[model samples]
Target chain A: MPVKLYIDAVREALWEEMERDSRVLILGEDVGVRGGVFRVTAGLFERFGEARVIDTPLAESAIVGVAVGASAAGLIPVAEIQFADFILPAVNQIISEAAKLRYRSNNDWHCPLVVRAPYGGGVHGALYHSQCLEALFTHVPGLKVVAPATPHDAKGMLKAAIRDPDPVLFFEHKKLYRSVRGEVPEGDYTVPLGQAQTVREGEDVTVITYGMGVHWALAAADQVAAEGIRVHILDLRSLRPLDEQAVVAAARRTGKVLIVHEDHKFCGFGAELAALICEQALFDLDAPIQRLAGPEVPAMPFCPPLERAYLLNADRVAEAMRRLARF
Target chain B: MMEQARHRRPEAQWRGSGGEVHEFHEVHPGEPPRHRALGLDDAQAVEMYRYMLLARLLDERMWLLNRAGKIPFVVSCQGQEAAQAGAGLALDRQHDYLLPYYRDLCLVLLWGHTPRDELLAAFAKAADPNSGGRQMPCHFSDRKLRIFSGSSPVGTQIPHAVGFALAAKMRGEASVSFVSFGEGTSNQGDFHEALNFAGVHKLPVVFFCENNKYAISVPEHKQLACANVADRAAGYGFEGVTVDGTDALAVYQVVKRAVDKARHGGGPTLVEAKVYRLVPHSSDDDDRSYRPREEVEEARRGDPLVRMRAYLTEVGLWDEAAEVDLRQRIASELDEATAFAEQAPYPPEESLYWYVYGEEETSHAG
Candidate 1:
């Protein structure tokens, strides 16, 4: 299979999942008729029918809540929140009820559902349309949060998420959806959740990142490789049950690390990784872990300079990579 | 006939209508229904007493844990034990389901959750059975007991219960799903949406609101313009009934009827269990900041545990000595739970990656 884009992978995954399981369904605004804002769910309604690919009201709460209800009833509902920023309205359903149902009941019943949203900045999406809120979801227990950077991972992880018997928040980086593509197997396959993918291997310094940050980090690593600094890049596919072991092992190998994330630096998922590495794998490090995050800026801006400054692009990652290599 | 002609279509059927329909269920004019009966025997009564007492003790201990810096937070259901215990006993664990809010510690335990799990969840210990120490205390989940986990947000579970009930109907199963939330949750738009959908679809559900008269600092007066939570049911086109939540027997009888009605395809019912939150909203909250000490003292007068003790005494089912013994036993058990959780290992650094999705080995091994 030739390399495919993330959005195409998502489309193919949904198409394949619906084809494989009659119980799987899609519900969200413009998802059915308008083919979703990003067209990730384009043509789904035509193929799966309206009942399967439902065009829900503009209520995000209802979309998520109804999905919770539908999932509790034994349907595998993949609900799209359109923009990740719009997900706050439905946060209660995802954070409180959908996440805790099985734990509170002591494993009596399980909420087997997936909530999909287009997250992150780039493409000039304003504040509301762009945000890497994986930390918010990861901070919550009883919920599984996954963000894939490649088409193959998207297809594999999404299929696995749909089949899993718990609620999962699947974040598709809006910037990478159409831009990032790779070969995804046509047959049944699943990228295990809570695992990290080593996108590039090196030994001088490790770059730990996820979602869109993976691409930026990879780009930085490639640039740094020209200077003879080997950078080990670990793309965190999942945020909640973060692959700490992979991070620890990589940290141990390089003895230096740079945490890069599109989310603001303060209280970001990168902070969690920093804490874990310090708490358990501190002895293996040669220097303090450096993090080059999007400037602790407010958010995505309408202006090009402001947006560029707010997003953690390849340049920042490259600078951080060089700094860590020196360390 | 003239009155019927003059009256407009009930507002419960649609949004923006003030007729009191909750979420999706409606309350049409009719005789109020009850829950399925729990055939109480001496042994079962004793079990209920133990469960209620243990729940109360656990709530108090958790509150202390929060104060002592052992647990991060606590949401105690002190005065609402009878309602939770009796309603829990009324349901068929195998066929029915419960979607509880954060305050439903007893209901969670009664439905088969262990105290060890609750303690771990409360302490945010890595060994926490609910989410591997991911969620904060009181946020619980399990897949085996047919009980839905709860989030911190109120009123979100209402529609989930409706969906579960709808599934039961679709599956041709004689099952009902009961969702429990506090009185303040009725103010939410989702609450109305869930009730309306339940009533319109005739889904087998019991929407029970533990009317404790407060949403953190806001009292029932500010929470709703309606006279009572049950009164809002009139808008939903189904029978809404208000029961004394402190009275276990009364709550049991009413809930039993509602469950029975649901099981027999009578659709959903809105049952409001009027009660009170004896403790502060949570360990992190201080009731004195907003609630008058006098009001807290007054609310404490009708504690459900005391009422149950009186009821059991009148029926020659309990006495002072029996109460002391039971209290001592429950206290000891809760103490053990706290000690066990404190000593349990924090989630291993590597263990963080476990169980996000069910491990194929575990899912298939079992």
Candidate 2:
């Protein structure tokens, strides 16, 4: 096994997949010569040439819309939105066109498009650059949403997304791109979509989270272990078509569940997780479901104090876990 | 009655130095016929006229069905039949892809959609090949015929057409993607974005704007800040042409040239077909609310079907017997389609849950 950064894992997936299948192409702003704004797609343009690594105009709508059309025409298109906040202009293309193509055509036409965007806050990227929009796409029925927390998951899930017969939204946490590192398998492998994995097992409380929140929960679990309060952690790799069985099983194991995410606490992905937990394992719960998420502000502010106060960390997760354990 | 009205109106004339307006009859006293000059033989010209006539009859029948409370909606292609039929016939239907808007009955028919298929979709029957009763009427799609599925969101199909062209270029195929929309749709951001992308990439796609003057009550002057939709193509670095949509031969010549240029790697073209909507926007709309009734009656005088028929008759390829026989044949086909669609069953209740995702693993596994 070789250790790799989360961003490198994603790059490797693109490099390997494009090498394996000539139909796999990348299109977005600065993806050709510049190798993407964050260097996530670095060196791909040089290797695959201009035809596969397309550099599009500054329009987000065209980037996604063209991908939708190309996917239907038997080419695997992986479109990139420069930032998650800027993806609003392409909501119509993503939600209305790509999401409904197969269903509207009655399976006569399908869009195998993968739209990747750098999301989440932490590196002083306030407001516009730092936002989690996975919840918005998760609400769309025909689209599959995924957020990978580790290098292993990022590489495998991206390969799966590119291979999917339908449209997929792959949200990469910008903060974890270079910060997270783990051992990734050398050869081709895939982490199936719509499945959840239990990272840490315990007998006290279960912390369900994804993306950046997953790392925070794991740290909190380790910190709380000193106090004899064992914590269970479940990383939900797939948001849409949620792993209901794993969610319920995690809830039933410890009888105390705490949901965590960086999105708004109101109507966030955590709310859906809470609803699913209560619906399936309501009687198994020893205490009420606890949710730890960002405050309901419009977005993350610029200043360090305000930004720190807005985002969740290991201390915040530990405090929430302590409160739930006391209950 | 129509012949008497035709004799009443003055001879249609071409004006403007820019060629924005075209003469109704392209055959001058001494020169060759316009269709012959455009490389269309006698049979091809007659077939174009027949397609325009079939579209008119089919559209008129849809209106009757709507008025009789038999169908839910009617989006007429009354005044733009020449633009549809002529441009459609010019494409290499065997290899090209069509992304048509709602008012493209004639174009889809030229691409292999039969009168019965249109009727089945209009009735929202189970056998409807477009959407299996899921979409509204005129939202065309047929995988076998290479007609890309379109939605009601006006200009969204523009980029999709560009994508098809992009794929064709990538695969080293000489396929052109043809897309059509109304004049108002040119204002959409997707339209500009799609055109710019296609221009930069030199993709093989054609952006056809059937400028029917009004986009559901908003007149052309109110919709555009420039003189013509075709003029906007210059900003994207491409050739743009404006032609009279009522003259089938003129439209055929322009579209054929554009398609040929695209297939040879010359990039995209913006073609604006100046025409009119001969009816209200849809069955639910009432033209009396905004425009005067006389304006619509005036537009009916330049109907593409009527103009194409007159051209065919002048060229000695059509006569009273030919007209009567064509109408009789279309009437029987329309009658049979109506009866079959009216009795066709709606999609099954459980079908609503199907096709949301593919059932099998269509992924390219390593």
Task: Give candidate 2's error at residue A230 in angstroms.
Answer: 1.0
Residue B311 Cα positional deviation in candidate 1, in Å, after optimal superposition? 16
Off by over 4 Å in 2: B1-11, B14-25, B360-366
Q: Residue A160 deviation, candidate 1, in Å?
A: 1.8
Encode model 1's per-residue lDDT on A96-159: one tens digit a residue: 6787665544344567989999988888888888887888888887888999989999999999
Lowest summed lDDT window (length 10), candidate 2 chain A: A271-280
Point out the worst 10-residue segment of candidate 2 chain B by lDDT: B1-10
Worst 10 residues of 1 chain B by lDDT: B1-10
Please list the C-alpha lDDT of all candidates, in the order they appear: 0.79, 0.90
Model 1, B115-134: lDDT tens per residue? Answer: 78888888777666566577
Q: Kindly list the per-residue Cα lDDT of model 2 for residues B208-321, writing each as its tens digit.
A: 999999989899999999989999899898988888788787788888988999999999999988889988999999889889988887777666676777677777788889
Which candidate has the highest lDDT of all? 2
